[model samples]
Target: MAVVSACIVALSGCALPRSGPKDDEILAGSKAEGGPVNVVLVDNRVAVASYLDDNLSFPSSFTGAGLASTDTINPGDVISVTVWENVDPALLVGPGQKQAFIQEIQVDQAGNIFMPYAGVLKAAGNTPEQLRRLITRKLDPQTPDPQVEVRRVAGDGSSISVIGGVGAQGVYPLVPSTTRLSAMLATAGGVTIDPDVAQVAVRRGGTTGRIFLQDLYDDPRLDVALRANDKIIVEEDRRTFTALGATSTQARVPFPQGRMSVVEAVAEVGGLNGNTSDPTGIFVFRREVQSIANKVTGRNDLGENEPFVYVIDLTRPDGVFLAKEFQVRDKDTIYITEAPFVAWTKILTATSQTLSFTADVVRVGDLLTDN
Candidate 1:
C-alpha cells in the first residue's frame, strides 16, 4: 500500500513546468500571489496529520435472502417457545416445574440443537424462522401446537473486527444474511484519519483477505461481506517521509491517510531558512520507477531500475515559485545547501558592469593625462 501511494506522489510531483517568468515584475507578481508550497511531512500538526475515517453503516439490503446456504450452528444461542397448552409455572415454583416450562437449548459441535421431543435437530443451516418450523414439526406428535423462535444470542451471525483508529475494538455483528466488510466498519464506527481507508483486511479462519477501501466507493461490490472470525485492519496513508541533507530540520513527517505533495511537505517543516536554504538541492527520492520496472519482468531484485530523485535548484529567481506547487511523499528527505556565493557574485557583477560602462565611455588615459 505504501508503495502504491509513493508512486502516486512521485508521478504527481513532476508536473510539466510552466513557461519561464516573462519579466522580473511578472515573477515578483506571481510570487506575491502564490506562496511557496509548505508540504512538510506530517508531524505533530493533527490537522495536517489526520485523514478522514468514514464509518459505513449497516447495509439495509443484507437480509435473509442474501445469506448463502451453510450448515453451522453454535452454542450459547437464546430461544423462546410459546406452548399452546402448557401451564405457566412461576420461577418460584418447584424447580422441576419451572424447568419444564423453559427449555434452554444448546447446540452441539455437530450443528444440532436440543429441544423437547426433537432430540438433536440440525439448526446451523436453518434461519430462525426455518428453525422454528423444524422444531414445530418435531413436537407435533407431543403437542398440538408449538411456537418456537430461535435467534443468535452470543455469536456473530457473521462478523469481522475493526482495529487501529476504529471507535471500538470488538467484533462487529454482521447482518446474518449478507453483512459486508463496509457494513461491519460502519457498525464499529468506521476508521479514523490516522488510520485512513488505504487497505481493509479481513482474516478468515487463519487466511487473510484484503480489499481497497477506495474501491468500495468506486465499486459497491468491493465492500465484501464479513465472515465469522474475520479481522479487519486499516493502515494510515502516511507513514515515513525520506529526509535529505543540510536543512536544519530533516526528519520524516507523519501524515494521516491520503497522499501529500513535495511542496506541501516543505511548508510542513516551516519555510526554509533564508540564509541556509538552497532551493535547488531540494529533492524527492522515490522508488516508483524501479517498482514498476520490476513488475513486468517478474524480478524481485532492484536490478537496473533507478529510484527517481528530483533535485530542484531554488537559486534561480523563479525557483521558489515552483516549490509551492511540487507535491511531496512520505519518507522524503529534503536537503538544502546554503547559497554558494550569490551575494558576492551579484555584487561583483553589478560593480563590474558599471565599471565596464564607464571605461567604454571614457578612456582611462583621459582621466590620468588630465590629472
Candidate 2:
C-alpha cells in the first residue's frame, strides 16, 4: 500500500496545472501592462473581417523613370547608308558609275561614320532618320538631288537584361512593337521557380521596385512597358512563418507570394493535433513597427514596439470564418496550446500501469509461497 501511495503521489505531481496563463488571462494581463506589445483577443467577427479586407493588397506598380523610347545611334552599331543620284551620277562617283551607292559602315568609338563624299560624319546620338537628313545635306554640293537612306542593322545598346532565377540569362533586344514587361520575360524563357510564389524585380536608372508574379498575371496593367537597360529579376518568395506547440508539425513554412490567411497557414502545417491541441488557445505571435502597432491597436503608449500576441478561440464555430480572414505575415509564430485534459490523461495512464505491475508482483509472491 505504501508503494502504491508513492506511485500515486508521483503521478499526481506530474499532473499539476500547466504553467502558462490561460487565453483570457493573457489578454487581461496585456491590458493591465500597457506595454508597447499588446495582446489582442480576436474573438469578434467584425474586427477580423475588416483587417483582412483592408490590409491585403498587391504591391503598387513601379513608378521610377525608365529608358526612353527614342533609339539613338551608339558606338558599335552597324549602319547601312545608301545614296541615289538619279541624273548626275558622275558628279558623286566616277564617270559611268552606277546611279546608286550603298555602303555598310559601323559607328566608331568617336561617334562618327565615314562616307565617300560626306567625309567623316557624326552618327552617334542621332536617330537613323536624323542621320539620313544630315548625310543628304552634306552630299548636296557634290551630287544633284542626292537621296540617302540610313538603316541600323545590328545595335544591342538599347536592350533590357534578364537574369537570376530565370531559365536563361542574357540581354534581350527591345523593339518598339514588343516592349511590354511580359514580352521581355517570355523572351528570357520565363522564371525558373514557381511563378505563384516568385517575385519580379525591375531595376531601372537608380530605382528598383518589386511585384509578385501573380499580381502581374491578375492585372494586365501591371505588365508595364519595358525600357532599354532595364533589369528584370525573378526570385523565390522569402515570406515564411514558424509553427510550434500542438500543431501537427513544427517547422518553418513558406507562404505563397500573395496574401495568405490563418486558415491557409494552419493547413500548410498539417493542421492542429486533434487529441492534444486546445481549440481555445490558438495564438499568433508577431512584432510590428511602432507606427504599425499604434495604428493596429489604436493605442498610443506602445513601449518600444514590442511583439503582440493575437489569440483566436477555435472552440467557437465562428472561429473558422475568422481564421479564414486573419492574415498571417512573415516570420510569425503560430502556436496551439495543448488541451488541459491532456496532462491529466497522461498522469492517469501512468498510475494505472504502475498499479497493474504492482498487483502482478504480489500475485507472483503468493504463488511462490504456496509452492
Candidate 3:
C-alpha cells in the first residue's frame, strides 16, 4: 500500500483530471493574485477591442532595437531594382525621364540581379537597403560615386497578412526589421469593437505565440518580431455575455475575452439601471473546472465536480470596490441587483470596469444574496 501511494504521487505529474468541479478548480484557475478565471480564459481570449490596431511599416526610427526576425528569402522570390550610374539617366531614366523602369525585381536561380554595370549580385538574406549598398559598392569603382535603389516589386518582404477583427484584410506593407505586428494592425485600420486581441496568432515555420494587442499600448512583454512569409491571424472566441436578474437593462454582449467580473462589468454597461437598482444580488456566472477531464478538453461549462458561480454583493463598501477593478471574461453573465437607495450611488466607482463595446448595465446586489 505504501509503495502504491508513493507511485501515485510520482505519477501525478502525468495524470489527467477525471471529471467534476474539483478538477476544474485545480486546472483552470488564474495565476494572478485575483485573476479572471474560467474554462474559456484557459481556452478563448481577445485582450482589448476598443483600441486602434497599429499597421505601419517598421518605423524608420526602430533601426537600433535588437529585433530578431528569422525571415529569409528563398528561390522564386521576385524583386525590383532601380540602378543609377553617376549622373547617367539612360539606364534607369524612363522614356520621358519622368520616372523609372524598375517596378519589380526578380531573383534568378543563380541568386543575382543583372544591373547595368554591377552585373549580378547576391540578394537572398539581405534587406533592400543592404542590397542597394552592395550595388553601390560595385559601381563606385567605375563611376565617381553611384546611387542604387531597390524595391520589392513582387516578393515575400513586401507582403503582410492582417486577419481577425480589423476593417480590412489581406497583405499590407512589408515593413523592415523595426516593424512589429501591432503596427500592422493599425495599418489595417485597427480592430472592431468585437476585437480578438488574445487569440491573434502569428506563425513562422512551426513556431507560434498568442499576441495580446492591448499590451502593445504599454506592456512590452507581448511584443512579437515581424518576419517575411509569416502569417498574422486574428482568431475569434466563440462565447457571449448573458445579463440577468435585478438590473433594469440586461442583454447578452459578445463573448471572446473570457469571463468578466461583477463590478468592472456593471460599470461598463452604464452603471446600475438608475431608476430601480438593487445594491445586493450581484452574481456573475463563471465556469469552474471540476476535474481533469473537463480541463484537458478546455471546457468552460461547470462539471458535476465544480459549479462556477460567485454571488458578489456590491452593497458592502469593500466588495463593491473589488467589483470595479476585477475583470469579466467571456461566457460571464454579470447580474447586478437593486440597491436599497440612490444613497449608495454617492460613492464613485473611480476604479471601475474597463470600457467595452457592448452596452453597460450596472446591477445592484448584496454580496451575500443567492441568485
lDDT of all predictions = 0.51, 0.75, 0.52
My TM-score estimates for the predictions, one after another, are: 0.55, 0.80, 0.48
Regions more than 4 Å wrong, model 3: 1-65, 68-73, 80-105, 108-123, 126-154, 164-168, 189-201, 220-223, 234-239, 255-260, 269-278, 290-305, 325-327, 336-371
Which lDDT tens digits does candidate 1 get at residues 309-336? 3445556665554554454555555555
Compare candidates 1 and 2 on TM-score and give the better one: 2
In candidate 3, what are the lDDT values of residues 157-218, reduced to their tens digit?
Answer: 44567776777887765545336767777777777645432446666667655544544555
Pairs that collide in candidate 2 are: 36-302, 36-303
Candidate ranking under TM-score, highest first, comes to 2, 1, 3
Q: Give me the candidate number with maximum lDDT.
A: 2
In candidate 1, position 129 carries an lDDT of 72
* Residue 301's lDDT in candidate 2: 70
In candidate 1 the C-alpha lDDT for residue 324 amounts to: 48
Error of model 3, residue 354, in angstroms? 48
Sliding window of 10 residues with minimal summed lDDT for model 3? 42-51
Question: What does candidate 2 score on TM?
Answer: 0.80
- Cα displacement (angstroms), candidate 3, residue 220, comes to 4.3
